[model samples]
Target: RVDGEILKGWPTPTGKLEFWSRTLHDWGWPELAIPKYIKSHIHPENLESDQIPLITTFRVPVQIHTRSANSKWLDEIAHTNPLWIHPIDADRVGISKTGDLVRVETELGYFVLKSWITEGIRPGVAACSHHMGRWKPEGHKGQRLGISTVALNQEGSEWSLTPRKGGEPFASSDPDTMRIWWTDLGVHQNLTHAVHPDPISGQHCWHQAVRICPAKEGDRAGDVSVDTGKSQAAYEKWLAMTRSADRYSPDGTRRPYWMLRPVRPERDAYHLPLKTESAEV
Candidate 1:
């Protein structure tokens, strides 16, 4: 509309570009109905003395998402998501070497990864690629260039991942699979991450505040340790932050009809049937 090509107006209910979202107010989030500043979950001020900001949003220039893991040339250049730590933070954490293994502990669990100490990253902040770290179960199919074969074991409320094998030279159809030299294809760090659903927007908060420490005994590179019980607790903690549709629906509908969906469902499907309590109760 700024270009005034057609001048039809905007898509909102008001038929104008919305500065204040009436839909959000009617749907139970009045504070966020208008454009305003909100504190980020990973704001550095919210961090404890021991914690540092973990920037997971950055990916290598060559690597795309999981699909690019199969690209041999890309994997050769950016195979691992090394923990990019600044020299000051590295020295504080007792990391004197660039390739030293470091344990990054999140709210749910911890994963060990190699630290790349450099001045590129800011002090008191560390970053790892959002890409990389693709894994497959021992018997599952995985990419040849940048995937690790691992065993996912679960016992009760505990889950553990053990690396059975990493990318290695093996004869295969492409013959490049046999030329695979890198054994460390990065770590599956996401498995240890806790869900961080936004209370109003209903989006997941990706950045995390984590504590970095020197790798302890028995901690191997790419090793991930998680307790399903803790993860469940974290899930519940984030779930409580959301305003459920059942409690906040504006017109007994699951979602706003005007919202765009790739495959739209029937209008009747949007309504939720009224529940009646049984007399036996």
Candidate 2:
């Protein structure tokens, strides 16, 4: 079949690398069928006048996700997560300089973290490491190498996590515990972050739309506040953005069989129950 033919064409309905995805079109996302520019949730137009995007994709090179705390040496290399803000954004937000605390408010709540003024980050958006900000409650047993002992309190829908202690050397039976030297384990940022799901991909959206300002009067560094009620509402709002497969599945299946999924059901199980109408006179 060589009329300038494919030895083994790409995996798709067309048997080729696809610029236009029929699956996306058939699966309730016609808008995303073609490879074209689509505005993201954090597109400038989607942000409010006072809001800027909070990028949490950065992680310290020496650190591993969640496992960094296991290594005292790695924790010593990088434990603290300061909000990396551009110098201009800092000044605009009333931050005097680096080491200043800034309150980053999302729809659910805010977290107070030290501001790091540098050109290393792009202007108009702030960044923080997703790997840091590990914390534990005062009496709770957690890793000693990289965590803050915070007092977590809740009232109604409001929740607050305030650090009682940062990383520091402490007398313990283990010599490694005595060797602790750093004092900034970072702030617990997830407490203030709400669930954001991509409507189509269904992946957790981590880029946050946030308002940055100088920390409030009572705010301490590493302080986090969240309204759980607002958190729930954010979930529902994003959930509505999606199109239900039950209604949109042209083949009456939960998903197209060609699409690879980790766990899947039989063809019959992919179908929705048939709807019935009551008899009328």
Candidate 3:
């Protein structure tokens, strides 16, 4: 029994044993080192007091940082941004299935999204999957126009507008060209998270405070109005700094000489710049 050893208690101060293992370190990895004796234990007391109104958690597999919606395959799986809420809490807020978009507000900012009432989440807590609804680029496979002509069309399924379709030339009538007009494509949940600090750890809790409400008809998905005056001011200040002559290089270059690094040449790579007319002939 290795008693009072610091390595024994990892991530927790008491170093309590967590799981059963034959070796002190499993799989020949130092990070996996654990005491064999510790069995299952509950550490609910280690968490912050339940009375604390604000808490922070994260989304599940359905969402990934602003990119999942770009994939037609992924979007087809999880179509909408559904806020998972406890049935009790859902009732309190008058939210229900088929509910219109709900406003999720945090100290950082607020935005409207659809609600999905489920018993899966704890009653004073709400959850959302991070993986759905991705921002569509000017032209991509899952955008409104991209879906109509390419993805939905049975004839030209081969002409997808994604990285996979990179080398393939687009058909002339491809509706992907209309995607340029599609704006305000999808919701970005990060904007709803505020920058709040955790008192115990002095760490910023980005998801600390959030509230949900049903969105009225005509309300756009990503519309959130929070005061970003400070951010605008900072941008203006940065613009002013960049405009100053002293910030520029002596030779009128934007970047300073020391900051630039020389590019190393690749010795073993093949290089064919272009075919000569004689060679083509």
The residue-level lDDT of candidate 3 at 219 comes to 62
lDDT per residue for candidate 1 within 1-281, as digits (tens), equals: 56656666666788888988989999998998888877776776788889988887877798888878778888888888899999999989899899999999998779999999989989988999878778888887645567888888888876778777877897777877777778888888888888887876567787888999999999888888888788788878888888878999989998788877789899999998887887893
TM-score of 1: 0.89
TM-score of every model?
0.89, 0.91, 0.44
Worst 10 residues of 2 by lDDT: 1-10
Better of 2 and 3 by lDDT: 2
- How accurate locally is residue 270 in candidate 3, as Cα lDDT from 0 to 100? 22
Candidate numbers sorted by TM-score from highest down: 2, 1, 3
In model 2, the clashing pairs are none
Tens digit per residue, CA lDDT, model 3, 11-62:
3223444464223222122333544332111123322333112233455555
Error of 3 at 248 (Å): 38
What lDDT score goes with residue 237 in model 3?
Answer: 42
Q: For model 3, what is the alpha-carbon lDDT of residue 89?
A: 74
Would you list the C-alpha lDDT of every candidate in the order shown? 0.84, 0.85, 0.44
Backbone clashes (count) for model 2:
0
Candidate 1 achieves a global lDDT of 0.84
Which regions of candidate 1 fall more than 4 Å away from where they truly are?
1-6, 139-143
The C-alpha stretches of model 3 lying farther than 4 A from their native spots are 1-57, 66-70, 136-186, 197-204, 216-218, 229-281
**Candidates sorted by lDDT, best first:** 2, 1, 3
